[model samples]
Target chain A: MKTIKSLHARHHELSDTHHQLEVLNSEIFTRHYLPTFREKLKTSGLLPLKPTGIEVFQMNVGYMCNQTCKHCHVDAGPDRTEVMTKETMKQCLEVIINHTIKSVDITGGAPEMNPDFRWFIEELRKEYSGEIIVRCNLTIILANGKYLDLPDFYKKHNIRVVSSLPFYNADKTDRQRGEGVFAKSIEALKMLNKAGFGKQDTGLILDLVYNPSGAFLPAEQSLLEADFKRELKDHFDIEFNNLLSITNLPISRFLDYLIETDNYEDYMEELVLAYNPKAAEGVMCRNTISVDHAGNLYDCDFNQMLKLQIESKAGTHISEFDLESLNERNIVINQHCFGCTAGAGSGCQGTTT
Target chain B: MQKTYYDPADLKKFGDIAEYGQDLADKFFNWYNDVFKDGALSSREKCLIALAVSHAIQCPYCIDAYTSDSIKRGASEEQMMEAVHVAGAIRGGASLVHGVQMMNKAKKMLM
Candidate 1:
């Protein structure tokens, strides 16, 4: 029932992206005789992974979140103060206006916590009528009075609301997210349902994301989706469009957890053994560019979190965006990428394979 | 050489039995995999059943395998524990049911 602090607030060493990467690339991996991700990729003939194109332009609006989930890769929490300025939003708007990008994914500690979040979305709607995804931590809907109308706002913009509900029940969901997140999430879902977000023929898409609560791969997506649908309908009378099964990549808080629980070596081994070439080919980074709160760009969200900027010749900021050079750049990859390529593969949209 | 009858790692080497008896092992593995596939019972249900049976038989390797398998199949913790209770009840009942014969013998001798 107690709140946990973010790694940044606690001054945990893993908060340093360099330290996290070193832990991921530690000698224990080689000592255990596990193959490096790059070696595995090369064996699969996918070394020097390149971009297919940019289809989704993901923006991390800020790191100021209401809740500090245990497995957060971004380490977002209320204690954090980093937020995106309107100037940065304007720069992103210019890129959106110029590029033929089909989707814009907005994510954050709690993106709605940003002061200018609504303004940015309104501006995006004006110039770009593409698919806009808001990664809403459902609890945020009930976090404050001002956020009470988020569901209606989303429906108005025709936003695709992708929310994380780790499991269908409270015990499992609360264990991962927080003490009472599942209850809040269910309430939030009901409100979204009332707003016709997940209803049939509403033209409003409400997708739920499911990642394992511990150090393990998720069950098959379609099977898990069926279970979520049956259980939610039978128990809570809630409905949603799709369930995206995501594999928890070893990074940030999750990586710290692996070490603390002594599951690091075994987990990394599992991921290595389950590496799928098909999944690697369909990695979201192949067709996505991630923009940080400060307007810096990276190959994908994970890369952005690690500060692995894109290898584009054009430039690494939205103000100097160039699709041609960006498309030609090789994606920045590391051991953590195995999370995306293992088993059926995982991305923001779910399984890649 | 292993000092004990079981090595946790041996579970991974299960397929190696094919080296000694390829035909039998192949048929066994094929049937085993097929048996677990979705049919009369959902694979999730089968996994829970397997978990219970593994506990009844007290196979360490099987207990380890089915525990992870059950989670991977999306079997809830509550359902999994209940399955084990089912196995425990049957095993306990099997022993208790034999007491009827003892009672019948005593009645025959006394009467």
Candidate 2:
């Protein structure tokens, strides 16, 4: 397999968020006669999309990852030096302590890579009793001896571990992720299972995320979940709570891949044509606020990557969080928003509709 | 006239067939939708089968439609290619089977 590098590491043009946004808003959309996501939403009676509430507070702890997965929207990789300091994490924790957010989702290039990851989680556990979700890349658990006990640590903290295992088999999974990722993921899953994360009657929740390895949109989430459950159980004796099938939004590395493969127009048309008003109404951005490593706030992770900060008058960083103002702020939309509204809809948890 | 009979864009206009014959088109599409629903043979399995038949009949539109349909139904690329191979095998076998008749006729004529 060919070695893949983060767009940022290679200093690729798409690594620049503005360049990515420009590509998304370029002439191909007009040539294809596809409506802007806002236009589509307006036609569906959903213009100026506003939040329902801030139910989930997602923090991107860092951009340093062990592996450079091709579809990463963050362009996260081993070479990335940007990581959240304990000070920034404290600011995030302060907001969590003051707010009534239902879930605190910690993500990253690999959230575990942050030196203060455990300290931050330990601190948050002390003051906030709400659900804490750590988006673990399964292989990260096996990436180093220092991280081997991650599954146990998560079990101790009762953190819901959502790991990405792109496919059940090696070939497809490794094709999207790096080679040997599948084997390590399976081993990590076994360790997670041993830690009682995905076992029956164990309150420790372990959910696997699946995004299509190609330009195509993901299949029906329930059907794909059933397939994953059966395949994992039969082949590897692995168990998990649920599967979250995410659509690869055309941004960052994925957007680069789409353009490279000459599938950009077709894939965008697919997303636009499959747009569901129902899905648009239930988009994750409506209830989730994503905070980046530096503590800046955005509607969701995708928007955070695009540098689309919250439009709230109150503030745009975690230190200046205003729940009421943030809730009223209209979500920043572009053509990429169509990815979330396509088919059954996609989000951090899975299908919205 | 267009240079070619098939335009890939025509696939998107398939629903427009209703403009010319609304009742028949409606009936055909409803039945088509029902036929692809999950049954004893899974929808994924049916998609693979349709993809193979698309190859056997050599319908460009059906080929295009079922290729995407197969992927969306979660049939792996390997599984899809195997289905096309099944169609290839059957079509090849049909031609080879007729060789037996030709051989018998030639033998009788020579005798």
Candidate 3:
């Protein structure tokens, strides 16, 4: 009875609030919502801020991959034919040398699947000599006869490999990936470890990536990493450096999935209600540039999917890169940005601030 | 007998917002299969995060779906609890930061 009464009273309160908001919104404009005015008025505020240094260079070598993961904002897959040529990589080297960039992060469907994959890595090593990261889908190491030597190759360059092992179990792993993927992933991780990938102070920097298979943000990094460590140790004897819990952005294949499944509204509402300015302030776009397969630049990879192109052509086609224009470019954002600016925040490299 | 499913009431305010509310809910359901598409993160892992997030902001529907999802994702009792703690810390920090509002208000009145 009390619950019913309270609910009824709550309905009355909401109705009253809605009526007041409607009046205020009508009096103001056709907005029907007044809170959004602050956003429109943001430039008037003197909360002076500056962009963080581009310490990480997230370079997209291509969209080719050995596996097709659903949450992939990159939409990379084995069927993808996009590959960055050597000339484009050379241009990236030029930007790294000319700019304040300090690290090189190479990502793809399976960054290792490109025919020029080895050459690209070799060239990057010769030119930059800075921190170089490869986002490896561990199973790629065992995908086919062609990729069998990747574990060894990665160790040769002392590459900091950030791979994905969604969970330590077989059923869940297979459910997200495909059949027999969990066993192969375990085999792949063991191979990487033998090649000194995730061993302590072996200095190979083997981190794991974690993302929810549904419509919510990721859990915190430390706790999830701990659980992963314990589970992998007890069961499959897998070890790693860290677990990166990334929030799934609502765009592209993901947007299509949400609409098809009917969880779009609740998920978006959840994200908006959980909006955290600290997360916003520390969003990765403040530092990184996401390059597409064609070499067009975006503030972050997520924005790239939404077609939010950088104001200026920083690196147009590997053939024509303008560092001056790249540095002067303004980052684009949209409502989907709420994904990054919520809770503890998320990014490719893991938690931000 | 499941507690905390989806409530349109909580989401009514987000009705017209781009990429959220009803459409996003629908989108989430469709995207469920896509999210599990072969890649780095597991479907179960994704479900665990979804469920924890549901609890973090008190989304009953998400909580219900993700509770079953966490289990289906093969998340152990311990693992699920750990994810909850992660959400706990962030949500806690979020509230504590907003204490700034109370602090500023107090300072203004006192000073």
**Pick by lDDT: which candidate is best?**
2
Question: In model 1 chain B, which range of ten residues has the least summed lDDT?
Answer: B1-10
lDDT of 3 by residue, A1-353 (tens): 00011111234332232332333233322322322323522432412222465677787878776665655566666656788777777777777777777678888868787778798788777766788899988888887898889988888887999987677777666665667777888999999888888899888889998877666666566767887999888887878888887888766556545656887666665666666666667778777877776777777777665556776654444445565665666566555666776678888878775
Better of 1 and 3 by TM-score: 1
Off by over 4 Å in 2: A1-3, B18-20, B103-110
> How well does candidate 2 reproduce the true complex, by DockQ?
0.86
Reference-based lDDT, each prediction? 0.92, 0.93, 0.69
TM-score of chain A of each: 0.98, 0.98, 0.84
Candidate 1 deviant stretches above 4 angstroms: B3-5, B19-23
Candidate 1 lDDT by residue in tens digits, B48-95: 999999999999999999999899888889999999999999999999
Model 3 ranges off by over 4 Å: A1-50, A313-320, B1-111
Candidate 2 lDDT over residue span A229-334, tens digit each: 9999999999999999999999999999999999999999999999999999999999999999998999999999999888998989888889889988999998
Q: How many steric clashes between backbone atoms does each model show?
A: 0, 0, 38
